[model samples]
Target: MIAQRKDDHVQLAVEQQQQHSGRNQFDDVSFVHHALAGIDRPDVRLATSFAGLSWQAPLYINAMTGGSEKTGIINRDLGIAARETGVPIASGSMSAYFKDPDCADTFSVLRKENPDGFVLANVNATASVDRARRAVDLIRADALQIHVNTVQETVMPEGDRSFSSWVPQIEKIAAGVDVPVIVKEVGFGLSRETVRLLESLGVRAADLGGRGGTDFARIENGRRPLGDYAFLHGWGQSTAACLLDAQDAPIPVLASGGVRHPLDVARALALGASGVGVSGTFLRTLLDDGVAALIARISTWLDQLAALLTLLGARTPADLSRCDLLINGELRDFCADRGIDPRPFARRSGGLDVPHEMTGSTR
Candidate 1:
């Protein structure tokens, strides 16, 4: 039990780094401000549909916790916010709750609080199909999010190192559950090749929990003596880069990791993401100002998204995904090395607002 508490502290502390880590990798993405965007603000739609369920906004409260009684409060607060805003709320890994039946209520609280809103249940990629079904039943979740954290396992003291066998297990769970299945990278970003495999196996959506956010490597290093692993703290691909690589993927993607304000969210949407998951920011807000403050912060984030959409002349979240953006600096070089043409962006001094219609939607 003490070890669990330690794990919780380490997770919370590392997640707090999101407050300082600036998510802006590209210095040149800007929308052409439509001064004549005569559309009424209230008429703007921020609604989005993911895995067949419609959400009020594209901001989903990603998985957090369900191990102990204390976690109940955090889950409850986030669930309340989801219920109020009509967004989806995801519960943390249910493995711990499955091990200790007494802690079941810790996760069940999410469904209790948000009966009408969409709730997503989570489990490690290594869980068996039966366990995955139990986790879904525990949260009354609308979907299942299978999280893969390979590096985190390598650094974590008790983390499982043998996750290769979990692929078939994932297939079993995906086949058994009627709900949509989403495979997610815990912190390290997902590669295009890996995405292609999951698509072949019938996975519906993917979330790129990329680098530049609460690094699990740094967190694990903090809990133990640091050396080679410590040097690997900033090793993964940036969220922006990963987004570009996975933009043309077979399934829709959710841009996570290092996302802070609404501008970050808007930029992600413009980069071809169907939605943005706000986790660390919500965790910090809950810790500092309580549940009400978290809700207020989310409300502000949603409003900012609406304003950004208006500025970009996007009428809907789908439209935002099609909006054009400019790439520059190291990002431009990286894309060029991969045979992508950066000439259009280099010709422009700043970012140019390319209409999604003119550029043609990747979808």
Candidate 2:
């Protein structure tokens, strides 16, 4: 049953990607072009540090699939891409392995294929400390991502209804696990309050798995008899909005969900994301094309990211924070209502003077 469910998830995710349309909040963000930007492409760097480890690139292949033969093949191909591209890869929720130990090899394939590369083991927030450790040992993971998906659970036909233990359980897992713990959202974005809660728990990082990517609510609803919960399809903040919410967070903020191309990756970095994760888009490429094509695409993204940084007058991923940005459309409204000052983002370089009302003060 678990294996079949995993397979369903993979198939549904692919179908969703193929038919997905409309612009995400990333569209509301625009970079202030620097015509006199003197930085050269060769001098621009993509290397970044997040989740207590150094990454060759600012982006990684986020958690996707495992636990079934079909999903295992997908994992193998993704692992190969990561190995060739020198980017991190994460396994889908290992809850299936805990349910059926026989499925261990499915998740283990990630380590088998990319022995020396950075691998992240994923588990739900409800996992006990012992289960969390086993997940890490299963993949020899350098880091662990404990995903919180209240919305997904609510919409999933067979999902858990209890949520009282999530925070306490996550705190225990974060403290007991040897590897760095990154609290992640599945598809819903993390809010500033939630980010603060993770920081208070002493977690090393947070992955703002914001909306605008694969819609798990829609997927879970598709499994239902009536296909209800369509109204909840647009639930939660976007990756770009979550990045704005996470400004100056004590822990490193990683962005994912709704990231389409290399420019979106650059936009996330400029919005203060230490790292970015691409799952649905990358998975679509691999399934539609082949592993070789995915590898070439990732390589192309790296090159494009360098050129973007040079064009923005930033020398490195961290330096992107200093580049100016202009927030408009619904995203600007979100900032105003959320008490976030969007002007700071637009005046990052301190080249333009903000108006009295546009000063750094939040509502």
Candidate 3:
């Protein structure tokens, strides 16, 4: 039990990093600056909406907590930040609520704090449909995030190691729920095949919680049996590769994992993510400095996002998806392994249709 609690806190700490420093995997691509004064920066609108909810910016607060007493305070602060920022916030796994009815308050505090703000409820893919359904109702969630983390589970001492037999479960949850269902990866990222599988389930969105941000395997290594298994820490997909795999996906993608700042948000939006999710960085701030600090930091991030979008000549999130980005080095090689022809960026033939909302324009 102590190990599980530690695991939970470690997970929260990782989310804190993602929200603060951000994962630096995908911001290398430069947005071509527009010198001509055709449009004023103030004229560019950064407002956008997703899943029937409006956001001042395209960045969403990803899932973070609710399994313990300590998380109650974390959720409270996080909730306050979300309400102030006007971005959708997702609650951590609601399994704890179902297991311990008394702990339901930890998860519900998010909705209670932000009555009108968008809140997404989450549950593991391995969880039963009834549990998933109950979680959605428990929080009156705007949407449901069914997270898949087979690799992470395998490594963790008390993690779930089930294979991909949750399709029927997911379909049942999706069919039963009125709100949109989003399937997400924990850290290892999703493949094109998995994205196709998710699309086939009629799911609406995917959060490619790719690697190079938080090392869950490494976290697990600290738990026990620290040997050859430690090498598994290097395993998993970078955020860039996951984005490329999910590009042209049937459903909109919510790029996540290592994203840290406005520039990362720009890169993700340009890569085709309808929006980006920041959990680690924000969680850290909430844990360390409290809600006020988190809000201030996120406000700065939003400002950076607005400035980036204006510089990219993107008037809105949709325009950010249409801008071009130059990919190179490890990211380019990662894309190639996944069958994406990076030559498009190299040949300047407009090879890849980089998501405009996330990337800066190169033209």
In model 1, how large is the Cα lDDT of residue 94?
82
Tell me the tens digit of each residue's lDDT in model 3 across 1-363: 632563566564655354444425585555544454123578777677655556677888888778677787688888889999888899987877777888888899999999999899998876777788789888899899999877777887777767767888887788778789999887788887888888888788888888856666766666666544677875778777788777778777788888767788888888777888987777776777878999999889888888877766677877776565678777777777777876454333233344676467675
Compose the digit string of candidate 1's lDDT tens values, residues 1-363.
Answer: 732653565365545554464635634455445454434577689988755667788889987776776677778888898887777888887888767888888889999999988889998878888888898998888899999888887887667889778778778888888788998886688877777877776788888888766777777666665445787676676677777777578888888887868888887887778888877778888877888898888888888889877766677887765555667777777676666664543232234456688656897
With candidate 1 superimposed using the best TM-score fit, by how many Å does residue 169's alpha carbon deviate from the native?
1.8
Candidate 3 — which residues are off by over 4 angstroms?
2-8, 11-23, 50-54, 225-228, 343-363
TM-scores for candidates 1 onward, in order? 0.89, 0.95, 0.88
Residue 330 of candidate 2: its Cα lDDT? Answer: 95
Q: Ten consecutive residues with minimal summed lDDT in candidate 2?
A: 351-360
Model 2, span 1-363: residue lDDT tens:
888888888889989998888589999999987666546688887899866599888989999988888888999999999999999999999999999898898899999999999999999988889999999999999999999999999999999999999988988999999999998898889999999999988789999999999999998888889998888897999999999999989899999999999999999999989999999999989999999999999999988888888777788999988888999999999999999999888777876333567456776
Highest TM-score: which candidate? 2
Candidate achieving the largest lDDT:
2
Higher-lDDT candidate of 2 and 3? 2
- Model 1 clash tally? 0
Whole-model lDDT for model 2 versus the true structure? 0.91
Global lDDT scores for all candidate models: 0.76, 0.91, 0.76
| Sliding window of 10 residues with minimal summed lDDT for model 3 | 345-354
